[model samples]
Target chain A: MSRRILNLILGCASVCVGLTPMRAQEFKLFERTVQVHGFASQGFIYTNDNNWLTMNTSQGSAAFTDFGLNMSTQITDKFRIGAQGYDRDLGQLGQYHPSLDWAVADYRFKSWFGIRGGKVKTTLGLFTDTQDLDFLHQFALLPQSVYPTDLRDATLAHVGGDIYGNILLQHHLGDLAYTVYAGHRSDSKYSGYSYFLTKYGVTSSSFAGLQYGSDLRWSTPLKGLLIGASRMNEEITDNGNLSLGPGIDFTSYSAVSRADWTNQFYGEYVIRKLQVDSEYRRYLHDQIVSPDSLETISDVRGWYISGCYRITKRLALGSYYSRYSITSVAGGAAAPFFPDQTDTSLPANHVYDKVISGRVDLNKFWSAKVEGHFMNGYGNSSFPDGFYPLANPGGFKPNTNALVLKTSVNF
Target chain B: MKNLRLLPLVAFLVLLAPVRARAAQVKIIANPSVSTDAISGRELKSVFLEEKNSLSDGSHVEPVLLKSGPVHESFLRQYLSRTDDDLRNYYRVLVFTGRGSMPKELGSDAEVVAYVAGRKGAIGYVSAEAGVDGVKTLAITDGRSPVERRVITRIEPEYPETLKRLNIGGIVRLQVTIAPKGNVENVQLLGGNPILGESAVAAVKQWVYATAPSRTRIEVSVPFNPQP
Candidate 1:
């Protein structure tokens, strides 16, 4: 009769309801092929110490659920259109907010050229756009250093356009794929950044920005070897209010990003049933916070190398070593409040996680995953890598261990 | 002693014969509506991969697949160079990404022949021993590496004046379908700036390729680098 149990039942029921219509992989509509697909996943998380991503994981919680439904149709030989709707409740993040993940009208004129415009997925690195299609990957969770779940909404898609195509290089050099895009980014109110800012007495009202990026990848002639690079530029502004002193003093505040950009490099190799992937990313944020007249600079560097092997048709084993660190932080007037912001050597400035995972495909459409994490640091509070100061008010331990069990069903 | 050694060699040859026969057991069968009597290895791969939809003779083609069988395994290994599971995963990706749809899958060689026989452009593969009475068997020629086709001519895409003035330059992708005679038959823009893609398509349409055994589809990239 507890509220937690009630919520769990309701969540499961909702996912079941969404999956009822996906029995037929696809159906005909007006003599055209209209495909319907959906996926739902529920996860249980438990941590030996410290809460993760706003979840009360110390006592174990099952407040992790996400689902998406999509339908696509090829209207013509060269024109296709599709849309996906997504919703998730991850601890205190996402908060069960439904979102239009992507709705694109894509037109392909040739194998080397195509254009899509609408709420389109953004292509950054190898997995940014495809992150929502979890079943395609072996690990329960992608490396937090590169593909953080907490920041999913921020980089998932954009309301703009993309031009993408694949090219076959001459002389057996290999194949190259390229995408260039420009779009507007609008973040949700229940996103991780919003919650993280609340702890600093900054309640963000709106977070909007303009983003443009280009991604180029080479599918080398060496069978399954792929290498790519991406560059993204963003201009964001967070409008909020700053809290002063103790009792009820608040002032209008704004975080104006002067320069924000990310550069990423990644490579993947697949030989037989074993696949290996690695990526390195550098993100720089320079902002001016008004009302307090503070200027802060944060330089984030993260990288991970992971490998997954399909031991059998139904089972897969994967492991990853991910490292995330705030290489530099310059908190002008806010240094006194957060001392670790200036001390780069402190454990609070970085997060190094080692994870091992196993997945079993119960059937063609259902899978279950068990993952264990051994983390060495909590990372900087200013940048949320699943750690929130408000969740761990008792302070964080130097090292923490956690277990995650997740099940996914898709059609 | 000599007879005993000969027995061992005979036994090895007997075991190897079946594998060799299985390698060539699959046959490509097409509906009578198809214009071409023969298909190259590269063209067969292109059709199955959903890259090229029409043959050089201007007949639209549709690929048919078997759910799973020895014939399916042999066709995947010899022409596609992919395992059954790999091909399935590839089709899944294509479907999920909205690039292509899954082909019609039949359970047995008889069902495949019946389906292809009834359809206009349907093509399928079956065991060589299967009675392909209604459908015609297309001989496979130039069974070279499926990825060996090369462009014999190149054309540079012109940068858009406005975009060039704005210093907006990037690579444009186009899918080019070439006829067996080596001339570009059709060009479609795959991805790039709209203006740049138009220019790329225009220029690529004039490019030619080395003579191929059959119609082939190849992706090409055109770069528009603006002056700094």
Candidate 2:
């Protein structure tokens, strides 16, 4: 089935290329062209907990891997299309799961304006939400906070449609470029054996959600340095049902500020929040527990600061520090079942993480990178409970560290 | 025995007298229409090097040269302090970069004289004995204080009796100072083909004195024909 799909994609690409008009005086059918390009990276990961390393459980380590492919073609003088897919393997048991990362067709009205339809990635906050994985300004491993575990895998990619454009402002003060966008998307979820048997008494349930987000970025020159600030908001509606009610409806707001000096030194700071109401519920066995109903309001807040230095034309070094904290206020009938049961008030949990990375450009079309991460305080909170149950207990140490190496090629 | 000795002595004196009395000959010429009193070697160098394209009378002057051979080599060494090989290589780079073109090269001294004399903007050099009616001689300078000497080699190749020509060989060194008006003011032998050095130097000095000074380097070359 996968081979068939790959063949179909290749066939479509060839047809697109064949349809292009050839240049004047040229015998070739197509002078203009389309291309498919992507990259894959795999590495070994060692964690503190042996149970977390599902592959070779006795070995006390895990292998991390990911790969993605993007196909882009110019359909006409004013129209273009692109589709992408990405897969990641947490461990052997988790296997390889692929997601339709993006599928969009864009019509450019002019040099500065455009409109797009189909499944599009939302331009929310900063970083890779709108751009592809390969175009990230930082390392492959993002600041853990802004890209939280739940949001990273839980949020849907390639939303329905979007309208986006940029405005250029050039002045004596400096030059400023602003990008704005609006879009909607659907979300999907996977269930574990225990959750599936105890909760809905089903193996899995696929749900679609409404996603809307907008981002505004402003850039200006101050003291001979270029500085910018951006703010974005996204809300997801839970249309699927749990025992207590519908799945948790949530809203996220993120803000980012950046300063660049002479294109040599750059620093950025970002803050994001994922908030859900108290009516949310999770079904376990014959009982239904309203995790949100017990709380007046609950939200997760995360932020990070990162800086990068260009060591040479093809090499760069960067480092970032990020922190995430979850806060909840308990109330109503379901308060006792929630974690931190001693207090009707929930104790805030925080995770502190730092990452240092280096990148080397092997050529115009190839690059390699290595990064190390140091995390402390709330290692138990990093992964989703349904994915890794052993790491949820409070007995485990809050600290964990890991290293990753990756390489990519594009043409 | 005494009479035989006198005949031998007189014959020896006759042969030695002309050898000792031979003075270096140099040629200098300008277009007949050019009313300027004379041209200095410095002014000539500036024009040939394209540093100054205008003459004293405000007429545009383009310098020409012989493409190759002993004359081309001798002339370039005497005035430009460069060899024909160096000039050709330099032009190759300049042309490739679209900076400039090489100077036009004529076939021989007669052709050079005829071309320069017939064209208003053209300037060229030839043997001292080749000087003709259409061209006039210009002054030259050795670039010494107090104007120590006036040495000019006239190329009257058609009238060999008018000038005694000698060939000196070695590298010729000439220092040229350009004036504010973009013309050559001073020409001095910096060092060269040692065999053609003296005649080359004298001719260059006289040429410097005859030309108007400008704020540009003007270095000219006048090669003496091989001694006949």
Candidate 3:
């Protein structure tokens, strides 16, 4: 493994120098502002007895890959159109093929109001828009607690429109951005979301429904300080990922709030070297499976704090502490095959993930990173229609460790 | 017949000479379609850097730049407050983030001036002595305070031959204190090469403006371009 890692580093460095990156080829098309950009990334993950993100992680897997090509054109000073095609193969999830990630025709009437229609990126938190932009993050993965990788498509974007605008509060010396969007999102049947369900005999389940949400961000007078809140309501119908034995159905609503602060303590030539980011996300779930037969309510919450410091112009070091817990789960007793259905204190139901990462810029468009995780619990279990491959039986408490190496380039 | 053969060569030199180290004066000019004739230096800076689309008067604007030249260098340093490489990197990040797009870059003062003159809402800068046939020259002053009135005529600084040959192009900065009566009281070099610094200082010393009671200190950048 060490030899492979060394070879990967050497090969990418050699290719990066020879690569003719398209990052700087931006020019007007037909005398209009049209810019094209794209990026690709690959990763290898190895874990010790933790069947998460993929099957049989005890050995290792290189099934994580992401690619995207995007272009945006400014038709006028106030009107713009942009779209991106995305593809990913995350172990047993994602189609491993291209899809219309987002395509929008955006029109800004003024500084105070704008309208965006078409497939739009979800307004979740600070990380929503740039989550797929690997080069933007110093960590191999953003905190899964706040940004679960498995929930990408379900939470990635909406197929509708959004009305967004900014409001200025002169006396307070701060600006507020508000966005309201309504649309529907789908959960892939082949994804882990469905895999977990199909394993329990749920052959037919639809996680698509009308979801509407709003996100608000307030920029305080302090230059780098911002506070944001996002609220969303989703009415979904699923069979509890269970068989036709009185199939289950339910709806869910969630709200996420976060704060982001960035400071420039060093390096102004290009990259601003140091940053600290933190976010807290909580979701409330209410499921009335089988109509009057059963009712369930629960709350899941998580938060994380991470800091990145650039030691040099080309090297960056980062560390983060993330914790997720199923604070409470009730009424699942009505659903078929649900054990410990009335309680949330079940073992392996929570997890504390600590990570350390190092990234090196091979060149202007290529970068590589290595990340290690120390886990204290197997709480990532979400077997019944969940992404994680852990099924905690006998209240097993397992500790695991994992390492990953990733390389990416964008232009 | 003998003189006729040399006519084209002489005319070519006259145009090519300014692209070299002969830059001395620069005039901020705008297309005829632009409705705003008076704009603050700060507002002008914002438009060219792709920060804002409209001037304070609500008129839209398009910023055109000389690809590489002493005047462009000086304009970026004094107005936009960034180095050449820094500006390019800035645009790259903007394009990458979808915040802004890179402005158009033309080759010479004549080209920029002609473009500005022909294109609606277009604005650019050229050698002050360069003929601006169809464009309108904007009035700018080092003083934003209540002290100095607007500038009527401006002078451009000569490009340093040594700096040009060495290809060490950048914006040279200076701090000028305007007297209450609009006379240039003092000029202090803030940043950039000393050779280019001297030329910039000499030209700014002769600038005249309307008068007020208190003096104003204006920080300016004089740029040197070595690329054709």
- List-wise, what DockQ does each model earn? 0.13, 0.01, 0.14
Q: On a 0 to 100 scale, what is the lDDT of residue B123 in model 1?
A: 89
Model 1 residue B97 CA deviation in Å: 5.0
- The top-ranked prediction according to DockQ is 3
**In angstroms, how far off is A311's CA in candidate 1?**
1.6
Best-to-worst order by TM-score is 1, 3, 2
Model 2 is docked with a DockQ of 0.01
Q: TM-score, B chain, candidate 3?
A: 0.56
Instruction: Compare the candidates by TM-score and give the number of the best one.
Output: 1
Lowest-lDDT window of 10 residues in candidate 2 chain B?
B142-151
What lDDT tens digits, residue by residue, belong to model 3 across residues B137-169? 775544254233455556888776645655656
lDDT of 1 by residue, B117-168 (tens): 9988888998765778799877564433342345678776676675675565
**Candidate 2's residue-wise lDDT over A1-411, tens digit each?**
453344344434433432443211212226544444454444444455323323322233323444565655555645667676766554432245577766778775533456777766654344435223432344756665555423343333445655544443433232333444445544434322222222322222332334444444443334223334433343423223334335744322111112101101122322111111011111111112233333323344556666666567578787878765554444557556544312212212555768888877665445567877776654222122212343333344546566655554433
When just chain B is superposed on the true chain B, each candidate scores a TM-score of: 0.56, 0.51, 0.56
- Model 2: CA > 4 A from native: A1-32, A49-62, A92-94, A130-140, A153-158, A173-183, A190-204, A222-296, A313-315, A339-348, A379-395, B1-228
Give residue A193's error in model 3 in angstroms.
2.7
Model 1 CA deviation exceeding 4 Å by range: A1-3, A10-24, A243-250, A331-344, B1-20, B28-64, B79-81, B94-106, B110-124, B129-228
Indicate the residue-level lDDT of A253 in model 3.
23
TM-score, every prediction: 0.78, 0.47, 0.69
